[model samples]
Target: MADLAKEAASLHKAASGLRTVRQHTAKPLQEFESASHDLSALGALGSLLGAKGDIEEGMTTLVKLAKQLDEEWETEAKFMGDVSDAFDLLEVLLTAAARAEKG
Candidate 1:
């Protein structure tokens, strides 16, 4: 029982750290999405203007890849945050149950 409480406390601490990571990463993810949007918009404008040179084509590819990367990053961050939340809940429930059992 003591060991269980200790493990729960450790997991709670890790969840807190995970929440911090989520908060810190969110701002950078937003910036990355903004940059990706700008690049994609520019690519569309260049295409409309018949700017089909090698550099422009390369940029178009880069924009596609950037958008994909942005999406993946967003998904990953959201999952991380969700996992943190679940861990937090579990820690709370386990701690409460342990206390009740002791009483």
Candidate 2:
């Protein structure tokens, strides 16, 4: 009967030790879960920054196209003005030639 009692006490001590080990193991797992959440949030932030960079690139492209169009129009306007002045000078020269032939 004494031996039976001793065995039961040993089993009780072993069970308590197991519970303590489980408690210690669970703390690290909880810390790992928290770190996992932080890493996931950082990944999402990185993706957002990449999207912002793409938008900036698109806007820069648009600005460059707009400036190119403005320069083309400015050059076209100057060319048209020069053509108009040349036509006017040619008409005046033709008039002078006609008057000189009359004499």
lDDT of 2 by residue, 1-103 (tens): 3443454455445544544553555566556544533444446665666754554456556555655655565565555555545555665677779899998
User: For residues 50-90, could you state the per-residue lDDT of candidate 1 as single tens digits?
Assistant: 55454455655765675576566666656655665666677
- In model 1, which runs have C-alpha deviations exceeding 4 angstroms? 1-52
lDDT of each: 0.60, 0.54
Which candidate gets the maximum lDDT versus the true structure? 1
User: Would you give me the overall lDDT of model 1?
Assistant: 0.60
Question: Clashing pairs in model 2?
Answer: none
The worst-scoring run of ten residues by lDDT in candidate 1 lies at 33-42
All candidates: TM-score: 0.50, 0.47
Model 2: worst 10 consecutive residues (lDDT sum)? 33-42
